[model samples]
Every structure is written in C-alpha cells, then in structure tokens.
Target: MKLPYALAKRFVAGESLDQAVPKVADLNEHGIKVTLDLLGENVKDRKTADDTLQHYIELLEGIHAQNIDSSISIKLTMLGLDIDRDYCRNNLFELLDAAVKFNQFIRIDMEGTDYTQATIDLYKEAFKKYGKHVGIVIQAYLHRTKNDIADLAELGADVRLCKGAYNEPERLALQNMDAIREAYKEYLKVLLDKTVYPRIATHDNKLISWVKEYTQEKGIGKSRFEFQMLYGMRLNTCKALAAEGYNVRVYVPYGTMWFPYFTRRLKERKENIWFVLSTMFQK
Candidate 1:
C-alpha cells in the first residue's frame, strides 16, 4: 500500500481558498506568519490569466476580512507571462492593485531559466512603482544569481533567497550540493548587506544553524530578515525558530494544480516519497 494524495492533505491546506483560509488563521494564532500561494502556472490564455488574477483578488479580500497576518506569493506564468509579456504585466498590476488596496504585499516567485529575465524585468517595473509592497525570489543555484542579487540590491528590493527547485544544466546552474550551499551563503551575505529585508528559504538544518550564527555575528537584528520554510516539511524547526523570537514565514500553497508542485517536491527530496508511501501502509 502507498499513501494516497489525500493523505498528504495534512501538508497541503486544500485545493481552494475557502479551505486554506482557516488553516492560515490557525497558523497565525500560533504566532507563525504565512505566504499564501495559489498553486498554478503557465496559463494558456488571457481568460485563464484574468481568472487567476481575480482569484488572487478574492484571496486578498478574504485575508483582509479575516485580519490574517500574511502575504501572497504569485507566479508570473500563472498571470499569463507565457501568453504575452504586457498581458502578464497587466494581470500582475491588477493583483498589485488589490494588494495595495488591502495594504498587503505581493511576492513574485522565481521560476525556471527561460522566465528568469522576464521575471526580473517584471519585478523591476513593480518595485519602481510600488516599492516595499513588492518582493522577489532569488535562486542560489543559478550561475547568474550573484549579478542578479547585485542588480536587485541596487533597487533595494526585498528578496527571498532559496535553494532552487528547478533542474537545469551545469552551465546555467550549480549542480554540486556543496557548491550550491557555498553560493547560498555568499548570496545571503550580499542580500543581507544590501537589501531592505532579505528572506532565507531553506530546510537544511545545518544551513539554518550557519545563518543564525552569521546573522548574529553581523549584528543583524532578528527583525531585519526572516527564515522561510515550506508548510509541513519542518514544523518543529519552524516552531523553534518562532519561539526564539526570529521571524519565520511558512509558504502555504493551495490550488487544484497541486500535482506538478507536489511532484516537484518529491523529485527534490526523494525520501519524501518513501515517507508518503510508508504512511499509506501503516495500520
């Protein structure tokens, strides 16, 4: 026997905003913030893109109504980046407008290599117009990340640095584990030194320890930066960090398009699949 996807529902809030809202509210009660993500990508048409933007608008409104302490993370492709750049930009602006109305923030999530430049371009446009209300993600595994960080720093953008999930060629990305970790640490230093508020997104315990020590050594206050972890992957670690009075945000993704996202998680950490399977077989 193997664990059904339904069993993993404990990890995913649900497939809709209605289902996710309560879960996020509960996390807030425990003193943990959330970055809510409506999980879908690479929309094929303008209609779908508009619909996605509307869904986010409703999500923002729901969060506002509930008085939840959370922000929304969005993927450009879900806003029609692949269909048309201007169209995508327009869709993003709609969501940004909603965020502005609610006095909330929108985090632009980084995708694969093909969309990298466009994503950065969109972030630049948004940051210029909205400033701190917008933030972007940086993938440490990418070879160009150093330059990317430097450019983003010049804009004083808020950035979340993550060990990338996408698989890429050696020329474009760091394939070695140690190399990626080293790059992550270096990038962390650059972001912390230059950006307004940088986010370190990782689940590796050793790296988390290193970051705690480095930030303290650099005299960076716990409020200046945050540690981000995916929902359910490391609940205890997240709680411990929160208990220590450090900012910790859990990335909570919800939508019907969870298969691709779930598969990506499995591919990144194959052991997770075994854990799922074992859970399914348990009496």
Candidate 2:
C-alpha cells in the first residue's frame, strides 16, 4: 500500500511551532539565520484571523525565549485580508506590537497579485510608525516591480525579492522563463543600487552567481545585504554562501495548512514532485 501524504513530512518541519523551534535552533548553529513563517492564507473569518494572530504572538515569545536568531513572516490573508481591510490591518498591528515587544522584525510575505497593493499599503502604514522593525516582499515577475523597487527604496524599507510563485496572467507577469530571469537580474540590480539591507531570495545557481559578481563589482559588502533561500530546497547552496562569509537566511515555513504551500512549491519545480515521490519509496 502507498503511504499517506503525512508520511512525506520531510519537506515541512511540521504543523506546530514546537516542531519548528528545534529546526530553527539547528540552522542558527550552522550560522544560517532564519525567518519563521506560520503557513495559512485567505482566512474566512475574524475568529480564524484572531486565532492566527494569537499563534504568532506565542511564536514571538518562543523565539525570544529560545534566543534563536530568527524573524517571523506572515501573509495578510492569514490575518483576515479577505474579510475586511481594517480587520486585517488591526491584526497585523497586533502581531507587529508583539514583534516590537520582542525586539524582532516581522516580514509581510507577498501573496498573489490580488493582495499585492493592499499588502504594500499596510506595510507602508506600519513602516511609517516603526521603520526597521518591519519589512515587505516584492515579486520580480510583475511588470511594475522596477518602479515598486524604486518607491520602496525611497522609504528605506527592507525588501525581500522573490521570483513569484502565483499563476498570474501573462499581462501581469512575465510568461517566459528567460524573460523572468532577466527581469529578476534587472530588479536585483535596481535593488542593490538603490536600497539598503535588501534580501536576495532565490535558489537558481546562475542567478546567485550573478548577484555575487554584481555586488562585488559594486563593492557592496556581504553584511550590507543577505541571500535567502527556501528551507529544504537548497541547503548546500545556502551553506556554501555562508561558509564564504556571506549572510544567508532560510525561509522556514511551518503550520497545519501546508498543502497549498507545498503544492505551490511543487508547481514551481516539477523535479520537486519527483524528489518527494522518490523519498516516499525510500526507507
């Protein structure tokens, strides 16, 4: 008989904070920083959003108590974006307040295009009040990202750049892989030239090489910016970068609603599905 998806748990830490805490500690020991993400999105009710907020409050406490060098990232939908804007904003502030108490930063993870503008708006509001304690993500595949980077750089806000995983329409996103990679490189250059403390989040070896060369040519120190990669996908690459004395942070996601997140990761790279299947058959 085939094993259930539960048996294929190696990809995710688990559905609880307790399951993820040790993983964060281990990564810190390896000299890799972490950004802990509690996975879930498009919450349907205030009760659900409130519950998620409470969990994040507890996560903030746990991180401080463990003395682990990790930050938390959250999606607006998980905080009730679909229900009401004020509700979402208030919930976000609640988490931000908790983050402030712990002297930790909270990154607002970018979602699909529908929530992009609202997320930026909320990020700006929080940033105006508490500057470096918060950050936001921008997707390079979007047509407007170049301008967005310029605007974000103006605020001196921390930005995390990703290749975007949502299935967006061609009009709104780059449809070709080469074009997307070109856009990624271009946007990264713009960020490095314009912003401070930008996070280069990618798993592509070629792109990583380009970042290294471009930053070195510009005399940007490794401490001025950091490279970020997904938790389980590029361990060797992350380790190599850190060993070379560059700062690197892993995007560590955990929580119960992992199916959607895992599916998106699989869709990003078909080989990932093959890897999961192979692991399922192994001891």
**Model 1, runs deviating above 4 Å:** 1-10
- Whole-model lDDT for model 2 versus the true structure? 0.88
lDDT (Cα atoms) of all candidates against the true structure: 0.89, 0.88
Clash number for model 2? 0
Tens digits of per-residue lDDT, candidate 1, 17-135, equal 88888888887877889999999888998899889999999989988888888999999999999999998998888788888899999999999999999999999999888877899
As for model 2, its CA RMSD to the true structure in angstroms is: 1.8
- Per-residue C-alpha lDDT of model 2 across residues 1-283, encoded as one tens digit per residue: 4445564365677678888889888888889999999888889988999999999999999988888899999999999999999999998888888888889999999999999899999999999887889999999899988888889987887999998989999889998888888999887777777788889999988889988898899898988889999878888888889999999999898887788888888888888888888887788
Best by lDDT: 1
Instruction: Give Cα distance to truth, residue 139, candidate 2, Å.
Output: 0.4
